[model samples]
Target: MLRYGLVVFIALLLSGCEMFGKKDIRLPIDVVSLQYDPYNYSMAELDRNATAACIAKGGTEAVAVDNEINTESVRWAYMNFNCYR
Candidate 1:
C-alpha cells in the first residue's frame, strides 16, 4: 500500500509539472483585427489571411483571438498579434 501511494503521488507531481511547463509570453505591441467573409473563405483560410495581415502590419507573431458566425452565413475571425524586436 505504501508503494502504491508513493507512485500516485509521484504521478500527480509529474502531471503538475507538465501543466505548468509552458508560459505565455506577451509582447509590447498587441494588435487585434477581424477578417470577415460571406462566401469565399473557410475558417482556416480566414485565420491565415488575418495572420498574414497582422504580420504585414508589423507583428512578429499572430494568434486568433476570437471568431463570430453571423446568421447570414458570414464568418468572422479575430486575430491578436505580438510584434518582434
Candidate 2:
C-alpha cells in the first residue's frame, strides 16, 4: 500500500508540466464580462463597449464575442471575453 501511494505521488510529480521543477509561474489573464439587457443593447454595441473596456483595462486588442437574444422577452447576451497583458 505504501509503495502504491509513493508511486502515485511520483506519477503526479513526473506528470506535472513545469519549469525549474520548483514554483509554478502562472500568467495572469484579464477576463472581462460585458453584460446587457435585451432590447436595451445590441450585440454589436455591447461588443464595442467590451472592446473599449478591454482597451481601458490594458488588455490585448484581441476580442471574441457571441450574439444571443431571447425569443419571448427582451434580447440579452452575457458577453464574456478576456485579454492577455
Candidate 3:
C-alpha cells in the first residue's frame, strides 16, 4: 500500500511538470529585469515587442540604447531600452 501511494504521488507530481514542453522563447527585452537581447527574435519583432511592452507599462516609446553582457556569458545586442514617457 505504501509503494502504491508513493507511485501515485510521483505520477501526479511529474504530471504537473512540463518536462517535455517547448523551451521558453527568448524575448528581445525583459521589461522587469531590464534585460534585452536579439537572440531568436528579429529586429522588427524585437522593436514591436519592446515598444508594446514599454507602452503597456505607461511609456510612450522604447529606444534601444547599448549592448551589454551578463555574467552568464549571454550577449545582449540591445542591452536595454530607454523608455520615453
The whole-model lDDT of each prediction reads 0.61, 0.66, 0.63
Error of 2 at 47 (Å): 1.4
Could you estimate the TM-score for every candidate? 0.43, 0.43, 0.42
Deviation in angstroms for 50 in model 1?
1.4
The sequence of per-residue lDDT tens digits that candidate 3 reaches over residues 1-85 is 9999999999978876766665654343334224445465566766677788788887767777665445366665344665666
Is candidate 2 or 3 superior in lDDT?
A: 2
**Ten-residue segment with the worst summed lDDT in candidate 2?**
19-28
lDDT ranking, high to low: 2, 3, 1
lDDT of 2 by residue, 2-57 (tens): 99999999888877845336674435367677766755657577667767777788
Best by lDDT: 2
Query: Any idea what lDDT model 2 has?
Result: 0.66
lDDT, candidate 3, equals: 0.63
Which parts of model 3 have CA positions greater than 4 angstroms off? 1-39, 68-72, 75-78
Tally clashing residue pairs in candidate 1. 0
Residue pairs with clashing backbones, model 1? none
Residue pairs whose backbone atoms clash in candidate 3: none
